[model samples]
Target: MCNTVKVSPRKLDPETRAALVDIAAKLLAEHGAEALSTRKIAAEAGTSTMAVYTHFGSMSGLVREMVHEGFARLERQFAKVRRTDDPVADMAVLGYAYRQNAKANSHLYAVMFGGQSLAGFSLTEEDRQYGRYTLLTVIDCATRCIEAGRFRQGDPRPIAHEMWIATHGVVNLELGGYLIDPANADRCYDGMLSSLLVGAGDEQRAVTASMAASKRRRRREVEVDPEPAEAVATRR
Candidate 1:
């Protein structure tokens, strides 16, 4: 799991390079992360297996790329939400977009933010920029809320961070199919957003709506997950 595998810098066109990674992501999404192999990815990308080595260094390098691209996808989605006079509404919409993107890209999301790195893959700081950028977008949205007098007057980073933490918990649980009712995604999701925004000065109405939905859900749930925290962390 290292990026130390070396080759000459690629001379392939950028499109071809992107194609390789794109094919790899699609394969991983469809077939699971363990399906990745230089030969298979190259075959799908219509390139020589050596291209993986030349362009990405190794399997681990490719995994790194997949992880980063997942966050890049998030950045692009959030970018599509236009700013508005109602920053609170804007933030709420962005939150919904975040969850939708997660649902749409579940497999990629699993690989990227999943609790563990792929075998033969290692993550470096550079691999984290896209994810970091997504966080920055959240902070930016929170900043807008504050400037619009929707949130408490203060640094938006912490506010953004709190929202992010809450968001991640729901996203992760949903990704694991731990939701009490899969069909109730919107309800739990809204609850989480409402819970986070309560601190931002939004009316508690969303909070009440979200909580009622949760209580209805918990009544039918059973405790089936027995995986230890460390195990979940290592292989999630």
Candidate 2:
């Protein structure tokens, strides 16, 4: 009888899995979703096509994990924004965190937000809801603002949604190359946040103070841990 041999698929470690997800994100960003191919991704990642299957089951599985990774990064950034006694200031910091996350992960941001669907993958409603969970931090901040009388009485969900809409608009535009000048983009974003807070029943002076506090906090973060060169270059 002929000897029989069995070969098991190679298992990917956590680091390799994360690297593959990032590689996929970069490819998706550079080539658009429809252009993504498992062979290309595997080649660039220095792995076999079977590695993708072994790790993620299929190309669609890898894309789904990309969406999860994007939101996971955003959640981590949001988690770093410590809450303060000033709810409005806290909310402002959250907004900044949202923008920072997008800038840091621009390649994944579009995929995370449904801007482009991968050729073989579509986000289910469940996946969309998972992304929305990242907004809970904002909702909590809005609730505090309402409780503090800084914002008009309303459901926190709508208030959070409004903030998300405003922030996302600016971020989307900046990513699309509409807001090219970094200085101009910063000014526009600050102005938009201030206006939105004012419209939400915050006093102009209070919004100004909150924004200043947010800036100070952000500056301290930079001083402690500066952005990577690539991120700075991307901004410029």
Top of the candidates by lDDT? 2
Q: Write model 2 residue lDDT over 1-236, tens digit each, in one string.
A: 99965335444443556667777788778787655788887776665677787788888898888888889888888888888989898988888888878887887787886766576689899888867999899999999999999999988998899999999999999888887686688789899989989988899999999999989897554222323323422332
What tens-digit string does per-residue lDDT give for candidate 1 at 20-133?
A: 666676677678767778888776665578888776778778778778767877877777666756566667666766776777767567777645556567667777666777
State the local distance difference test value for candidate 2: 0.80
**What residue runs in model 1 are displaced by over 4 Å at the alpha carbon?**
1-14, 29-33, 205-236
Query: Which candidate number would show the highest TM-score if scored against the true structure?
Result: 2
The TM-score, computed over Cα atoms with residue i paired to residue i, of candidate 2 is 0.87
Q: 21 in model 1: Cα distance from truth in Å?
A: 2.0
Per-candidate alpha-carbon RMSD to the true structure: 10.5, 4.9
Error at 83, model 1, angstroms: 0.4
Q: Using Cα atoms with residue i matched to residue i, what is each candidate's TM-score against the true structure? A: 0.74, 0.87
